[model samples]
Target: MIASMWSLLAERRDFFAQLALEHLAISGVAIAVALVLGGLFGGLMAEHQRMAKPSLALVNFLYTIPSISLLGFLIPFSGVGNVTAVITLTMYALLPMVRATYTGLSNIDPTLIEAARGMGSTDGQTMRRVKLPLALPYVMSGIRSMATMTIALAGIASFIGAGGLGVAIYRGITTNNAAMTMDGSLLTALLALLVDMVLGFVERRVGMRGTEGRATNRRMAATFAAVVVVGALVGVVRALAPATSPAIRVATKPMTEQYVMGYMLKDLIEHDSGLTVELTEGVGGGTSNIEPAMESGEFDIYPEYTGTAWNAVLKKEGAYSEGLFDQLRQEYADRLGFEWLGMYGFNDTYGLVVRREVAERYGISSYSDLAHVAGQLRLGAEYDFFEREDGYRALCDDYGMSFGKTMDLDIGLKYQALAEGQIDAMVVFTTDGQLSTSDAVVLVDDRRFFSSYLCGNVVRSQVLEEHPELRQILSKLDDTITDEDMSAMNHAVEGEGREPEDVAREFLERKGLLQ
Candidate 1:
């Protein structure tokens, strides 16, 4: 496994290197802020005994908030991307710094402080010359821990649409690529270790400076200063880098089909319109994040589904049908200033799938058939399925079904769980790559419980007016993709390890939509 990891690293050094720099920039900023804020707060607490308990309690409370929970909580206020990520990391890094400094200052010998005072030292002078110097070791220890934890936590920033090694990890899991997952995990661990080593070396050097000499101390300080300056410069450059770009920005949800379709649009836009397109893949929370970004003009276009627009965007209930398409389109334009274009000609709706043996034994082939045996079977689905308004409960109520047990499974692990008999049935999407080859029976939605989710390109109306010619180019995808084509493309990326762009490019050329 280690050798395979090294081989993967060698194959993708440039990819990992870019993400590593982003991780460092994010973690660095958070650590720097924590150090400053924590130092000030620690100093204040040390000076005031009354302030100590409350300050510690507050940070401790923040520290106890789960990382994912904190991120979800911050999204409405801060929106998405780097700002939310940095705030999350800084909050987590604070507790260590505050406690360390407070402990160090409080533990200082009163006799030593008195001797300095007896020598005609002012209270300020005693703190600066005597107490602070003695507490350096504790502060260093805190910084070391704070820096390490920050680096490790920074990987999660990618999960929320910020760039980092977590992109590789999350994408790998979504694509079912083990090597990619390992590559990301390996990179994060290496980055954390590297930061820990650098801090450890500096802490040791500072500790030994008094015994070593003024000249050695000066050299050590210079080395540390140079490192900090370089890191700060890199971060500043990244934050201030000119985006002077006129490229049309596109975004995608974190799914294999979306990745392929996003690349197809990007490729076709560049090919036919003679315009640049910058595609941002895997935009975290799907419509919840991307829709707001679109409204805010952070993105110009993204692929969306009809039922999602009807239910999630418009807040209308029941299944989408041909009669509702016009209303769906008009409401989007009226309410959100958005336009739907380039219908992909596929129904990527939900399905209830069961192990073939279970279906055969129970004679279950539709929701009605399953309803009779549901109480004897265990059902599994992703977390969202249970929480969605038009999801689990609605379906169960419609079909008058109740499973023996319902398991909340990760989107990726449902199939494995079904195959292992941990679950007798699971929820699936019609175009999921795994469905093409899995030995499972897809039960018909006899009662039409779930809504139709026809896919399309959703564009901001303002962008259409600005680049009127872009409309014609994007329409090339209208009614082009069928369920079979999409399922094959998804399978290529998820099941066969083929790149999404390569699969998309091939399909477009085959359809004569690309040169």
Candidate 2:
């Protein structure tokens, strides 16, 4: 595993290097801010007996909020990017910093302070020359804790457009590639350890500065100053990087198919229209984030399913029926100001699947067929599949399925579970790339409980008004991809270890859509 990780690191050094830089930039800014503000507030609170308890309580309360929720709350203000990630992570670091500073300072011996006063030192002087120096170790401890956490959280920042190792991790999960996940995780872990070690060295050197000569202390301070300056420069550069010109921001939900579709859209739009397309794939919040982002012009376009927009967006009940597209188009335009574009000519809906051998043995060709044998089988499904309106409950109620046991598994791992016979059946997407590679057979939806999930580009209505030519260029994908085409493209990327952009470019070139 270590050898494989090293190989992966060597192969993707350039990509990983930039990701590491981004991670450093993010964590650096957050730690710097937390160190100053948190240390100051903590020190002040330690002296202010009346304010200490309430302020610490507030800091503790802030710390209790989940990282994801804090990130979501900041999205409206920071607008989804490195800035948001920095702000969220900075907030997370505050409590530890404050507590460490307070604890360290409060534990200082009062006799030393009295001696300083007896030597005619003022309160401020005593704090600076004696108390602060004594508290340096504790403050360093806080900084160390914040530094480690900042690095770890920076990986998750990729979900909100804060590019870091988390991007690699998400890409790996979406593609079901273990090597890629390990590549990102291992690097992030190593990076955290490096930061901790560096901080520890700084802490020890600073603590020993007084015992050493003035020259050594000056040299140590200079080294620390240089490090801080470099970190600040990286953060500034990342924050001020120029946006691509004439670019339409495109987003995608968290899945392999969405990523493939995102790449396809980027390729075709760039080829036909010569527009710079900024694609942000695998948006963590899915439609919940994408829908609001489109409405707010955070992004210009994304691929969305008709049924998902129908049920999740429209908040309507009942199974899908005909005229779903028309309703979605009209309602989106009227209510959400989004214009639905051409369909990809595929229905990527959910289906209950079992190993081909199991299906054949039980003569299960449809949902009705499975119902008779469901009691004898154990089922597995993605966690979200059990929560969707047309998910486990609706499926079971409609098909009268009563499995012996049911389990909610990670979507990425469900294929492996079913393949290993840990599950007799699983819920799968109709157009999943894995379907072609796996020996699983999707049962027919005899009761039609699930809705049609016809997919296509959804853009803000105003974006179309401005870039009228975009409609024509994007329409090139209309009725272009069949279920087989999508499945094959997915397989190429997810199974064959090919890049999504490569697969998309190949398809477009083969179709004469790219020059």
Candidate 3:
């Protein structure tokens, strides 16, 4: 595993380099912001006892919120990507920073301050010459803790479209690629350790600087200021960088098929409209996460399922009908400020899957056929599929299936489990890339238990208005990707181990869409 990870890193060295830099920048800015704010707040609260309890309580409360939830909450205000990542990570860093500072400052001897005052020192002089030096170790300790957390949470921020090491980690997990997961995990650990080491050096320097003369202290302070100024400048430039014209952002869920679609859109849009396309793949929460992001202008377009938008985004209940498409488009436009483009000539609905050999041996050609032998077989499914209304419970109840054993497996690992014979059957998507290569058979949904999940582009209406030609550009793909085409494309990536970009381009080129 280690060798494979190292090999993958060597192969994708440039990509990993960019990801590492982004991770560092996001974490660095967040820690810097937290230290400044937390230091001031901690100092004031140390002197003012009454405000300390409530203020510390608030910071502690913010710390308790999960990183993913916090990022989601910040999306509406900060949008997706670096801004939201920095803000959320800063919030996460506050508790440790504030607490450490207050503790350090309060622990200093009152007699030292009295002695400084007796020497005719003013409040500023006393703090700079006596109190601050005494509290330096404690404050530095807090900064150390905050720095570690900022780096770690910055990784999690990748779920919200923030570019960092977390993106690689999540992608590896979703793709069931052990090498990719190891690469991300290893890099993230090294980064955290590196940050800790740097902070430790600074902490030691601050502690030792007390013995130096005024000249030395002045020089050290000046150097620190210069570093801060440069960091701030770099941050401003990144935050304010203008996106190129005729540009649109594309996003996708954390799955092979979604990734394929995202790349396909990037290729087609860039080729047809001569526009710049920035694609952010594997957005967590799928459509639910990406919908708010699109509404907030983080992403201009993404492929979404009509059933998912209805149930997950719009929170509608009950089964869908044939007219669902038109209603969904109208409601999305009128209420959600988005528009639905053409379907991609396929329905990637949920269904049962079993090995072709197993299906033939058991005479289980359909979901209803599974009922006879369910009690003798083990099944695997993803957690989300287990929890969704259209998922496990309804399917079992519809088909009257009661498997002898069931396992809630990671979405990425489920296919491997099924292929290895660890599972007798598993929940499968009709359009999964693995379906073609794994020799798995999708059990017919004879009872029509699952809803139609028509796939298409969901774009911000404002984006369409701004680039009016976008509608035509997107429509070029309408009803072009049939089930067979999707299956082949998926196999090209999952089975043939091809990059989604190459597979998407090859398909588009074959279709003459690149012309």
Candidate 4:
């Protein structure tokens, strides 16, 4: 285990660095924006007696909404990515800074303001020389809180394709790799600590220097000058840049959407034909990642589940099967100009997984047994499973079973909880490629509640015409992957600490998909 973890960490060192940088960038930008906006609002509230209660109440209300929920609500308008993540983080960070500013400014000595006025100072001069200087420490305190909040919120931003240490953690959880999870958590904590210390030192230094009264005005002028210069350079670059690229670009769902699909295909497509295939992996899970990219022409190829494409992509709602797959394929080809490239030889069906020991003790051999014992078992599942139209809620309603305990966990953590015996059962993907190695048993779905989730590639009709050979290569891989093969391949990347690209290449070569 130690050797495997070391190898995995060594392989992902660059990714970790990139994740750290992304986290810092997102957090820094959000905190900076919060500082300016929150600071200004706080100052205004401090001066105006009537605005204080309403403004404070508003910031406090925003602070109460869960970060992830807020991100989800923003998805329709903003779509997923760094933009949504940053905006949410910025809003979340505002409360602490605004509250601190309000408290700091409001608490400043009225005597100091009176003294400044008595010295023949104007109202603006009294604010600059007395109240503002007295409130510096309070402002710094708010900034510190804002910085911390930003760091915490940035971690959650990974779900929306905002790259950060959270992505690493989420990946680890989904794959049930404890080492990866620990690495991500440790790194995030370290980043937060480092930022706090640096900012703490700066805050102290600035507080000690005292407010220069004129420093804010000077800083504002410098900032305006910098923005003007930067804008001019950006305009010049845009004018000089070429408008077209010769390489064929392929867009795919983010990493979380279809897990390993795009990652698996990255090398296969690139090396097979020497084509410059651009892979755009969505960070958001299936629906959010696949639809927008496909509709926007941002992606040319993405793997979509038969069930998802049927119900989600095609807007056809009913029970699913291999037949639904063909129908959806034909529908998409005719209406959406998208081609279904056939199945990848395996169906990653959803099933109820129970600890082997628990199954043995109860003699629970099938879905019927689970229904009978449902009240005795604890269930663990991902958030979407509870809310999606055809998710766990529907399944449970059909079964007429209520779990004794239900734990909301990320897909990755569900496996861990089940393995640790913390949960009696969990929703699991059938072809996860790790079940064979784990001590869990998937119950037979006698009721056939789950739809077929055959793995396959889908591409834009135009891209297929341009790169017909690519389609043929990918088609040859259809239905060739068995459950064991997928599990093993997944293990190589998520378990053994190998790169997805390298694993995909080896699989293709071994299968003769690559010449």
Candidate 5:
């Protein structure tokens, strides 16, 4: 176990370093942006009595919304990655700073303002000299609060593939591996604590400048300048470092195919060619990821589901045909500037899964059969399904079936909940490895409510045009995975407590997909 832990850490050293850097970058940027915006907004509100209540109320409301839900909502507009994470963190940081600024400015001595006015100081001068100076401490306090909030929020950004300590934590939780969870949580807490201490020290120093000597201020300034210079030099060197070799940039989505295939392709590509492979994991699921990354040239290659591309992306809702996958591939290339790298050997279709005993008792075998017994079963589904135009809600409506209860759970936790009898049924991916181990029966979609979810790679047109050999390499990976293979691989991570990357590598080696 110790050896395995060490190996995992060593393998992910660079990835975790990148994650830490990204976390810091996001938190720093968000705090800075929030400080500026909040100060301005607070100043305006303080100046106008009429605007105070409404402004505070609005910011306060935003502060109350859960950070994860806000991040998810922002995905469509900002897409995935650092931008979305930074923006969400910024918004979260805003309220504290705004309130602090308002309080500090409003509580400033009215006598000081009057004295400044008597001394012929204009409103602007009075504000600059009297209001700002007195409010500096409060503003710093707000900044401190924002910094704390941003650091905490940045960890959750990993869910959207923003990359940070949260990535490790989420991966651990999904795979049910306690050690990874502890490692990630510890690192994240330490990062937050260190940042808080640094910021607190800066705040204290700044607040004490009024009582301190000019010599002390001068020394502090010089120290800050020296640190900045050294940091800049280090950044320059890192940026100038040459690319060692050809690298494959694979784009993937969070918690889905991108999570699975990213690891699979990374080890395979690196081992086979002895070249670096960069993975750009995106935020959303299949329907949200594939085309946009391909069109924007943000990703070189990624896994895509044929059914999702057709029904969700193309808006072609109809019966599935044998040649539909090929037809969609050609259409996507012609219309969307992407190349459909031939299919991988698995179908990750939607399955309506229930406890085996329940299924046996009810004699439920298909969707049509589900209608008769629907009144007795409760349903658990993903949040997206509830909101989707043609998702589980619509499916139930179409079948004229009503569930006894409904609940929403994260995709990773759904299986555990089902096994624990939290819900009678759940909509799961057909290729999920847990089905074989758990006493769950996947009801046949005989009515064909779901579209084909055949897994495959989709490359940006430019990537396809630039590296023709990539097509050949990826094509060779086609029809390589099976239902059992997926189940086994999932079990290695989600069941047997193995890391996702390890499971991915082991599968590739077993299938001879890796050299």
Candidate 6:
């Protein structure tokens, strides 16, 4: 595994290097911003003793939120990618910095403050001459700690469509590539250690300076200023950078098929049209996160399912039908200013996947049949499935199912649980790779509880107006991918360890859609 990791790193050094730079830039900007704002706030808290309690309580509460949860909370406000990442990182970095400044300033000896005042030092002068110099070491300690922590936490940024080493980690896990995962994990650890060591050196110097002459203090201050200035410059340049031509910004959910399809859109659009495609794959929270982003024009294009777009994005209820496809498109256009185009000829609808042995024992071949035996079986499903409008409760209600027990499992773990006899049944998608080979039965949705989810591209209408050719380019995928085709491609990545792009390109080539 170590050998494999080394080879993968060497092979993808450029990719890893870009990710490392992105990781550094994100952490650097976040820490720099936190340092400025948190130091100001914390210093104020120290000066006004009454404000300290409430201020500390607020920061403590924010700091206590789980990283993933915090990112989810920030998505609607900050949108996704580096903006969301930097915001979340800055929030988490604030507590350490604020607390450190407050602690340092509050710990100053009263006699020293009095002595400075008696020596004709004004309040500001006393703070600069006595309080601040004495507090230097503590502030430096906080910066050091904040920098190290931010870099490590930055890995979570990739989960929300940000660029970083975390992308490698997330992609590696999704693709089942152990070497890629190792590469990302090891590099992140090394980065944290490296930053810690460098900061430790700076901290020791700050402590050693120890309230030196005014000239010496100014020099130390300049050193800190330089670091913050550089980080801020990096962020400004990135934010202001403009593309020479309008690029198609595409986003995709955190699923194998979506990743493959995202690349397919990129490949075909770039091949025929004189346009560049910027693809952000594996967006966290899928439609929930990406929908708002699309509505806000943060994303110009993304692949979405008809049913998921209806139930999840539109927040509609009741069973969907082929008749509603036009209604769905119309609602999207009139309400969201989006276009639903390029319906890929594959129905990746939901299903009730039962253990073959259990199904055979219960004589169950359909949802209605399962309902009769449900009281004796346990069902395990992904957590969000229970929360989704078209998910667990609705399906069960439609089929009159009453399982003996229900377990909320991770999406990745439900299949394993079913195979291990920990769950007699679990929800699945028609294009699930395991369905192609597993000795399990996908009970018929006799009641049509689940809607058919024909895959398609959801595009910003404004973009389509600018690039009318994109409509033709995107429609090339219509009637192209079949159920078996999508399942095989998904299995190629998740099961056979092939890259999603490689699988997508191969399928496109076979279909004569690409050269």
Q: What is the overall TM-score of model 6 with all chains considered together?
A: 0.90
Q: Model 1 misses residue 328 by how many Å?
A: 0.9
Report the C-alpha lDDT of model 4 over 1-515, residue by residue, as the tens digit. Answer: 66756776797899889889889878877987898999899989998979999988898899899887898788777776778888999999899888888888899878878888888999888778787778888888778777976896688877776678887787776656678778888788888888889878766655555366347646855896899689668868987886454355454443332455665576667666757765544455656555675666656777777876776667665657886556787888898888888478777778888999989989887888888888999998876677666677778888888888898886656666777889998887776656667798889988888888777887788887887887766777677778777777777765665555677767777878677
lDDT of 2 by residue, 1-515 (tens): 67866777898899889888878878888998998999999999889868999999999999899888888888776677678888888888999999999988999999999999999999999999999999888889988988998898788787776688898898888788778789999889989999999999877767675545656978878897999889778868976887555788999887888888888888888877757998887777678777777777899999988888887888888876657667778988999899988678888988888988899899999999999999999999876677777778888888787899999886678898998999999988888889878988888887778888888889998989988988888788888888889888888877887777778888888988887
Better of 2 and 6 by lDDT: 6
Off by over 4 Å in 5: 1-17, 47-78, 116-129, 209-214, 232-247, 256-258, 271-276, 360-365, 387-390
* lDDT of candidate 6 over 426-449, digit per residue (tens): 888889765666668888877778
- What lDDT does the true structure give each of the candidates? 0.87, 0.85, 0.83, 0.75, 0.76, 0.87
TM-score per candidate, chains pooled: 0.93, 0.90, 0.87, 0.86, 0.87, 0.90
lDDT, model 5, position 485: 75
Clashes of each: 0, 0, 0, 10, 2, 0
Task: Let me know the TM-score candidate 5 reaches against the reference structure.
Answer: 0.87
Off by over 4 Å in 4: 1-11, 118-120, 208-259, 272-282, 296-300, 333-337, 397-400, 460-477
lDDT of 3 by residue, 1-515 (tens): 77878888998899889899999988888988898999999999988989999998899899899887887788777877889889998898889989998998899989989999998999999888888888888888888878887787678877877899998888777765668778887888899999899878766665564546556756988998999899889978976897566679999988888888898998888877868899998887676678888887878999988777777777777656557877878889999899988568777877788887889999998888988899999999876677676677777887898999999886678889988899999987787777766778878878887788878999898988888888887888889888878877777766665667788888888878887
Name the best candidate (by lDDT). 6
Candidate 5: pairs in clash: 345-479, 433-487
Task: Report the candidate with higher lDDT, 2 versus 3.
Answer: 2
lDDT of 1: 0.87
Cα displacement (angstroms), candidate 6, residue 226, comes to 6.4
